[model samples]
Structure formats: C-alpha cells, structure tokens
Target: MPMKVRGAPQAVVAILAFAGIVVALMQTMMIPLIPQLPRLLHATPSDATWAITATLLTGAVATPVVGRLGDMYGKRRMLLIGLALLVLGSFIGALSGTLAPMVVGRSLQGLAMGVIPLGISVMRDVLPADRLGSATALMSASLGVGGALGLPAAALVAERADWHLLFWTAAGFGVLAMALVLAVVPESQVRGGGRFDVVGAAGLSAGLSCLLLAVSKGVDWGGQVTAGLLGTSAILLGLWGWWELRTGEPLVDLRTSARRQVLLTNLASAVFGFGMFAMTMVLPQLLQLPRSTGYGLGTTMLGVGLTLAPSGLVMMAMSPVSARISRARGPKVTLMAGALVVAAGYGLGVLMMSALWQLVFVSSVIGAGIGLAYGAMPALIMSAVPIGETAAANSLNTLMRAIGTSISSAVAGVILANLTNAAGLPTLDGFRLVMAIGGGASLVAIAIAAFLPAHRVPAGTLPGREPSARRAVRISARPRPAERAGLPGEDE
Candidate 1:
C-alpha cells in the first residue's frame, strides 16, 4: 500500500497570507498622506517626499541582506524579526509629532517589505508539492491586494480620525501577524553552508542608497547634484560587482544574475515596476482635480479611490489567469502579453482622460497586466536559479522593481514640473505625456521578452522528468564556475 501523506496546516497558510497582506499594506499606506504631509508636517514638498524615499532606500538595502540571512539562518526566524521591526516602527511613528522621527520610523518599517518573500520561502517547506504553485501565486497577489486595499482605508482613517491612528492600526496588525506566525508556522531545514560576505553587503547598501537618494532628490536638487550622485553611484556599483565576484559567499550571486533568463527577467521586472507606478502616481491626481480646471474630472477622494479600487480587483482576478497562461505558453510569453496590455492601457488613458469611467476601465486593464507580469516573474527566477539562492535571487528581482519605481517617481516629477498649466496645477497634457512615456517603456520590455531564449520545460511536467536536459540548458544558460565560484554555490 502507498504511504499516507501529511498536509500543511491551513492555519499556517492563513497566517502567512495575513503576514503578506500586512507587509504590503505598509508599503502604500502612506500614499494618501503624500499631499497632506506638507501641511501636517510643516515641510516643503520635496522634504515631505523623504518619507517615501526613506522607506524605499531602507527596503532596498534590507531585502538582499534579509534574503541571504534567511538562507543562512532560517526563513521563519527572519520573518519574525522583520515583523517585529515593523511593529516597533509603527508604534514609533504613531508616537511621533515631527517629521524627522516619522521619517526614521518609516525607514524602520520598510524592513517589513522583506517578510513576504521570507514567508514564501517558508511556504515551500510547509505546503504540499501539488499546491505550491497556486499558493505562490496567491501570496504574490497579496502584495498588490494589500497595497490597493490600504489606500482608501488609510484615506478614510486619515480623513475621519487622526493621521497617527493609521500607524497605530498598522502596529496592531503587525503584532497580530507576528503572533499568528509564531503559533502556526514551522521551521525549515534549508540552511546556507558558507560564510556571509559583509563587505559585499556593505558595498551594495552604499551603492543603492546613493543611487536612490539621487533619484528621489533630483527633482529639487537640480542637475549638478543629480549628475554627481548618479556618477558616484555608478562607480560604487561597479566596485560592488567586483567585490561580489571575489567574495567567499556574497549576498547575491552576480554570475547567476548575469544568466540570460535571470538577467532579462529582472530587467523586465524593473520596467514592469516602472509601468505599474506611472499610472498609479498620475491617475488619482487627474481624477481629483477641479472640474473648472478644463482637464479635471472633479471626483471626490472616495470616488477616485473606488474607481482605482476596481483596477486592483481586476489584478486580483487575473492572477490565476496569468498562471494558467504561463503554464500554457511559457512565462516569457505571459510577460510580453502583460507588458503589451499595460502599454495598451496607457494608450487608452491618453485617449480617454475626460471621462471618469474611461479612467476606471484603463486602470483595470493596466492592473490586470501588472498582475499577470508579477505572478510570472518569481516562478521564472526560481526556475532558473538553485533552491538555495531562491530567496536572494528573488529578493534581487524585487529590488530591481523598487529601483524602477524610484526612478519612475523621479521621471514623473520631472515631466510634471516641466509641463504645468497656467494656474500652477499640473495639466492633462503632462499626464498624457507621462502615460505615453510609460507605454513606450512597456514596448521596450516586450521587445526584450521577444528576444529571450525558449528553454523552459513544458508546463506541469514532473520535477525530475528531464534532469539531464535541465542540466544541459543550465550549463549553456548559466554562468561558468570560474565566474560564480566566489559568489555562492551554483543554482540547482
């Protein structure tokens, strides 16, 4: 008789899903407060934007480090640590009355961004093989859902209650998530076998911080500072790459990252991230403008939020469809479809800005595109790299997306600044220009996807069905041992 098998705990999955939601919620919970920050904190627009910048910078630095630690120590423990940091940060922000302390708290809370990937790693340990793919897709979608759900909720709280209450609620959620994780999640045996490269981590942190700081601050700081920061960042990044190449156990395997599948997927992820944010940043402003402004639709905050909310719903609904499409046509094809859909959505936005429902339709279409793209990326990266490097590689891809968002923010600011109307309000013309640029960028991503090699296994095959074929592909597609030996073990 065949042996009976034990299934993963449903409670554990629930806790992990909740954890993903809370982490994602924190990412965009403050977005509604963006315009209000100047008045509430008595700061300039550029200074207030630091709240966003601080979180992005800290999250970017922490992601790869946390991923490496998850490999070396344990994902469950790392997840708990990240959640704890989030709770503490939220509490600190709630108590703060000034911008500086608030910025500090926001930066600390950014550590939580690493929790979802860590939780996904744990899910691999607990979830049955048959259910892993769907579970992974759901967890990935949770990130977008949490962000979308948090916005209106946060806006309502900020409007009716105190702004500080938002952070308090976040703190409460963090505590509950941590407790549930502790009670339900089991530890895994996936452990790293080498020393962690502190130097590489430091280099990466410095380089990314410098790069993001420049990008985030460039709108106010002008061309000289932006050029200088960008130049310094380039040099630091080059050095960081060399340091990783020579390190005993670097945080990221540069060689694996250099592989065609891994490299192109991450690059495409950056553009995907950029495209996603472009619509998000511009659309709300377009909807909330005064009707007299000629280009404004005069929608209320609540109305605007509701309209945008459906886009998120569309994204959630499309996750399964994206996975199915990926299975049938390969992830590369799904990715191209996603990029093209987003580009089409942007084109639609340019043509239909006057009508509120038209905006809603375009948003939903774009959200569906992002959902399809986001769901396929992790699977592609995981398939290409070794199991041990899974968290780090995935984290690096996530960081690329973050980098792309940061750059998009800068680019959008520049475009808006250059194209304001006579009343000092940003016009529909600027918004259209931004959307068109985003669409063009998505086209670039489609081209990249089109050129990607077709080496993926047919969907739904048994894992061990073609080891030799996988190895042969890996040999040709992966980097040489001489190139990767200093970084970490080759991807499985």
Candidate 2:
C-alpha cells in the first residue's frame, strides 16, 4: 500500500502492541528451562537461580532509567534501543552453554522490560486523540498477553527441540519487531527537555537493587542477610528520596508521584501485580504436582502450560472491554472493578483448585481483571502528569508492579516452603493461603483506587477522547511541552 493510503495509526498500534508482547515473552521464557539450568549450564542450582534474579534486578533498575531517557530524548529512539538490547541478549543467551554468560545475557534481556511503557508514551505522541485509550490499553495488556502465551510455547520448544531454541526464538521475534518499528514508527516529537539525571539514576538503581535483592532472595538466604539487606535498602532509598526531591532533573518526580491520583494508582498497581502473580505462581505447581499427593494434578509442563494459556488470551480479549469501562465509568472505576474481579478469581481459586478446568476458570477470571486494571493504569498516570513525563511516570508505575510481583513470589515461596503435608508435598491449605493473600491484596487495591481523585483527561487531550470544540479549549489549555518548545506538533 502507498504510504498516504496506509492506515498508519492502526499500523503503529499493532506494531507497538506486538513489540510489547515480544519483550514480555522474555519474562516467562525461562520458566520451563529453570529446572534444567543446573544441568544445562554446568552450574550449581544456587548459581543457576541467578538466571532469574539477574532479570528481576536489571528490569527493576532499567525501567525508571529507560523512562527518563525516553523522556529526555525520544520514546521511539529509546524503544529501539531496548529492542536492540533484547536482540543482543537473546542472541548471546542462545549461544551460551554455561551459567555466567547466561546470566549476562538474561540481564541484558531484562533491560527491554521498559519497552511497554515507552511504547505507551509513543502512542501518546504519535497517535490521534481519538484512538488513544484502546490503543494504550492493548499495549498495557500485552505484558499479560506474552506471559500467558509464552509458557505453553516455551514448554513445547523445551520438550521437543534443543533448549537453545528458546532464546533463539526470542531473538527472532526481537529482530522482526525491530524491523517493523523502524519501518513504520516515526520518532515522537514530544520530549521532556532536560539533562539526564545520572546521580538520580545511579541512586535509584542502587536502592532498588538492594530492596529487590532482599525480597527475592530472602527465602534462600535466610533471616539475618535478608534483614540486613532490607535495613540497608531502607537507608539507601531514604537517601535516594532526599536527593530526588532536591535534584533538578530527577529520575522520578517524587512530588508529582506523591499526588493523590498518581500515588494511589502506584500503590494499587503494586497490589494488583502481587494479586495477579499469585495464580500464576501457584497454579503451575498444583497442576504439575504428583497425582499421588491427592490434591496434586500430576501433569507435565506442557499440560500445565495448556491449562493456563486461556488466561492470557482472556486478558487480550478483555483489554478493549477495559478501555470501554474506563471511558464510561472512568479509569478509577475500571481499576476498582478489575481489583474486585481479581479478588473473585482468587476466591474461586481458593475454593476450586483440585481440577484442571477449575484452575483454568479461576485463572481466566483473574486475567480479565488484570486486563481491566492494566488498561486503566496508563490512562490514570498520563492524565495526572504532563505529556513530557508520561514515559518516566509510566515506567515508575511499571516498576511498582515489578516490585509487587517480586515481593509476592518471595512471600509465596516462604509460605509454601514451610507449610507442607506429611508427604513433604505442599499442602492444599498452603495453596489456599496464597489464594487468600492474593484476594486480600486485590481488596487493598480496591481500597487504594477508591481514594484516587475524580478526574478524566478530556477527549482530544487523550488520544481517543475527542472533546467537542466547546470543550476543546478547557482540554487544550495546558499545551504539551512540544507546543511550548516551538517544535511542530506531530500528533498529541
């Protein structure tokens, strides 16, 4: 099709959505290979765990930094850089046959986690005001989409082919996404004009690394180390906060983030992340547990993957519904609704986890909730902050979710490790306990979201929400930084 005739906006949404999915795939791609890591990499089990930890730490650090970079420079440019990192990491991981290089590669792959936020930021820049909500919703939901879709496929590849193919396949998708982005996506003109905050970045990275390290590794490392790490993290983060408030170009705007809308949303996002990850962590183990254990389903990895795949598809399907809900009831309402749905899902999981069909039903219900809340988050954040800060703000929200999940996993691990049946198998009660915690987290999310200030970005201000001429003045009163900077407005 000729360039003029092409539906460029639609194409941009599709490409960016696909890119988000591709990056998310990296998160769960290692799930199937985790057990085999010690043997495959000729490393100790403890050491092999770094393959997972490396990604978590780097992702936590990279998210805010990448967001700041995207704000200062261009979202599209940072997005491509993130994709290139994934490609490079995937290639290195594909070629690695041992532990050290594998950790290095996986850490590199983690940097790409920022792609989803950057993509959402770009949509704000380049997409029409009318298409923004749904487009951004779909992009946000891609985190769940790739994660859900990746597990079964990765299980299949891990079982049927060489393990190296997993990373190779990831690399292949990365390359394709990069090509599509470069070909069709234009550089966003909107920029947060400022110098990069190196001090802020380094400080945030250090604090987060210590904080997450404590949370994620506490189960393995025991009490004293965990407590010390936690204490150290608290100190460093306290200092980091002090510096951020005083700095000119901070990695995260603490004051803006402290606003009622942004603060509550981040808190809710964290709880939602924890709640959503509960089903994911528990279901697989329950499905793959030995049938002799009575409560265990005694299935293979592929069986577990297949049983859980519907949740991801459900998430993708529900994104538009979520967007519609946000449009009608407002994003805060959508978020609260999603939290309730997730709580209901976890409640059901607590009640009916013995059967495969039951697990599938429960997961899908939670997926629907995730789709709704995830879709609303960017809308809430974008409306609260200036156009220039969207990427950084979204990145911080994404980091909050990551922190939630990391903490959730650690908490679940501790519970499961200590509470077991006579056969040493994790008992049904323990699983229910996790579900209860998940449900509780969702309730907390609802409480936080309920307190968010009542406001909506008008149509035309938001990509999809087009206010009428009468209302446009009120919406457009605060011109985007691009307009003030005297650059020709490209989209928003």
Candidate 3:
C-alpha cells in the first residue's frame, strides 16, 4: 500500500488557492483607477494607460523566465520570491503620489504574476491524484475570481478612501500569501542541472519589450516609431529563436516547442487571450462614456465594476464543470467547445450592444468560455511533454497568451480610432467591430484545436510508476516486438 501523507488536504488546498487569488488580484486592481488618473496625476488618458500597460509588459517578459526558474530551482522558493515582489511593489506604490513612481510600482507588481503558475505547479506536487482535478480547476478559477472580486472592492475603497490605500491593502495580502506559502507548500524535488540561458533571456526580453511598446503606443506614436520598434523586435526575436535552437540549455527549448500539438495549442492560446482581453479593454469605456453620446450607459465606476463583476462568479461556477468535461471527453474537445462559446458570446454582443443586461449576459458567457479554455490548456501541455519539460512548456503557453493580448489591444485601439461615429465621439460601431474581430479569432482557435490528436494514458503509467522490483519485472516482461513495432496492444 502507498504511504499516506499527513496534514489536512483541504487546508493545503485553501492556502494555495488563496495565494493564487492574491496573485491574480494584483493584475486587475488598477482597473477602477483608470478614470481617476487625470485628476490624481494631472496626466493624459494615453499616459494613464501606461500604469496598466507597464504591469502587462513586465509580466509578459518575466513569466517565462520565472516559470522556467521555478521548475529548475523550486516552485515553492519562486512562489515566495514572487510574493515578496508583490509586497515590495505595493509598498512602493503606497509611497507614491506621482504617475512615474506609480508606474514603477506597477512594473514591480508584475513580477508577482508568476505566482499563479507556481501555485498550479505546487498543486501537482502536493495533491493526491483523485483530488488534483478539482484543485486545479479552483486554482485556475482564482485568476478570474480574484480579478472580478478585486475590482468592486478596490473601486469601493478608491471611491470612499484614498487610492493609495488600495496598494497598501494589496501589500498586506501579499505578505499573508508569503506566510501561507512558507507554512504549507513543500519544496520541489525536481532540479535542472544546466546553466541559465542569459543570452536568450536578454534577447527575448528586449524583443518582447519593443514589440509590446510599439503595440501599446502605436495609436499615439504614429507610423515611424511604430515601424522602427516593430522592425527591431522582429529582428531580435528571429535572432533569439535561432540562438535557442542552437543552445544545449535554452531559456525555452525551441525545438521541443515547435512540435505540432504544442505550437498549435499555444497559437490558439494567444488568440484566446486576445479575444478575452478585448472584452475587458472595451467594456469599461463603453460603460463610462457620457450619456449624451446616445450609446453610452453612463454608469459610475463602482456600478460598472459591479455589473461586470458577476462574470467572475460565472467563471468560478464553471471551473469544476470544465475539468470534468476535459476528463470525460478530452482537453482538445473542451478547448474547442470553449472557443465556440466565446465566439457565440461575441456574436451576441454584436447584436445587443444597446441593452445593459445584454452586456452582462454576454460577458458572463465569455467568462465561462475563458474559464473552460484556460483550465484545459495547461493539462494539454502537460500531457504532451516529459515531466522535466512541464514548466518550460507551460510558461511558453502563458507567454504566447500575453503576446496575443498585446496584439489584440493594438488592433482594437486602431479599430476604435478609425471607426468612430459623428460628433467626434467614439461610437458603439467601433466596439462592435472589435468584438466581431475577436469572434473571428476564436473560430481560428477552434479549427486549430480540432486537429489536435488525442492520446490518453492509463493510470500508473510512465511518470506515476513506483521504483520497485515488481515494477522493473513488469516493465522488462512487456511484449517487446509488438511494442517496438507500434502494433495493437502496444505500449503508447
């Protein structure tokens, strides 16, 4: 019989789940503050966007590195480091009364975004096999739940008290998360006996930063700067790819990543990320526009946050349902279904933009789709790779999603800029166009997922096998000729 571990598993789950929630909360706590930027910092709308963009850009660059490092060193160690960064960043932001300092703080907070994947990895390490499915689902839902819950609360705090208090609160949460991780999380046994790829890291970071900067600022920066930055990014990224292929120990294993299933899944993930963020980027603007525009809902920040907040609840409710569907049918099927749901939701938005409840309904539908899709992605990647490659592959998947969101933001901004209605005001038409484009991208993701092969392994297979004399005998006595030739009843 297997040796039973001590400690209440439920308590372990709660600690990790809360830690994941705190990490995700850091991502969207600034949403409510967008409107107050002009008054608080005396800055332009474009300048204020930097506060959000800075976090995104920094997170995009740091996620893959942190993920790889977590696998190499230890997930628990990295989780603690990430939480420390979150607390430090919040403290910095709390001390700030200016735009530049706040932006710096947001960048530091981005470092903590790595905690989500690290937390997920910890679940794989600690949870019993039967319990892992539900635990993983809840942990994934924490990303959406934290964002949704954080928004309304952050808005309430910002509205009633000082905006700086929001960061202070986040700092307190970060400290709590650190303590929980130290207390409950186990150290990883996995170790990478290779040097860190410094060259690849630097090259990839520079390339991605340039690409994201061009995308985020293209609306204001005009053609020349955009073209220059994009060109430089392309060249640097190409060089990085080549270097990764040649290096024995790469930051990301380009060859392994280039596998059909891995590549397509990641490509689909990018599109999914793009589509999901489009709703987030556009909804607040639509809600807050002046009533005179005839299309605006003219809602307050708190009201808008509440209205959109139910979508997170929807995601939380769907998490276990998605996991079950993936287990029963397969992850690719679940992913395709999610893409279709998202596309359908976007289609609904295009038809019913005038009604407030319609927007709420559509947002919830999209949130459900996202929850389903997000839960399936890591499972799909983990299924396809060796145990040693888990973190690197998952990190690449996360990075691809970030890249997609950056591109989507740029495209949506351009659409809104060009398609405004009369009276020099942005119209619902621009928003419609953006959603339509996002819907089309979801279709592409569905098609990609359709072609993904299904390979289901029985329990107690390769990674789960115990190191015992019976296991060795069982392995040695396996039918060799049939297995080698890929005949019927062969070992997959």
Per-residue C-alpha lDDT of model 1 across residues 1-492, encoded as one tens digit per residue: 111123345666667878988988887788878878988777888788878788888899999999888877778899999999999989988998778988989998998788877777666555554444455555666777787777778878877899999999999999999988877786666565477789988989999988998988876788899899899899999999998887767778887788877898889889878877888778888988898998888876666777788877777788777777766776777789889999999999889998888998999888888888877777667666665666777788888888888889889988887888888888788999999988988898888777665534355421212222221111112233565443321233
By TM-score, the better pick of 1 and 3 is: 1
- Cα RMSD of all models vs. native, in order, equals 4.4, 4.5, 4.8
- lDDT comparing candidate 3 with the true structure: 0.76
Task: Look at candidate 3 and tell me the lDDT of residue 409.
Answer: 82
Error of 2 at 214 (Å): 0.7
TM-score of each: 0.91, 0.93, 0.90
Off by over 4 Å in 1: 1-14, 455-492
* Candidate 1 residue pairs in backbone clash: 386-491, 386-492
Please rank every candidate by lDDT, starting with the best.
2, 1, 3
Among these predictions, the greatest lDDT belongs to: 2
Point out where model 2 deviates above 4 Å: 1-7, 456-492
Between candidates 2 and 3, name the one with more favorable lDDT: 2
Candidate 2 matches the true fold with a TM-score of 0.93
User: Candidate 2, residues 388-411: lDDT per residue as tens digits?
Assistant: 777999999999999999999988
Extract clashing residue pairs from model 3: none
Candidate lDDT scores, in order, read 0.77, 0.86, 0.76
Give the alpha carbon lDDT tens digit for every residue of 1-492 in model 3: 211323566767788789888878887788778778867867788888888889988888888888778777777798889889889989999998778988899999998777777776666655565555556667766877888778778889888999899999999999988887777666655544366889998999999999999998877888999999999999999999999878767888776566666777898999888888778767777888888898888887887788788888888778777678766776677789888999999999888777689889988998888878877777676555544545667777877887888899888877887778776556788888888988898898998887776644233221222222111011112122223232211123
Best by TM-score: 2
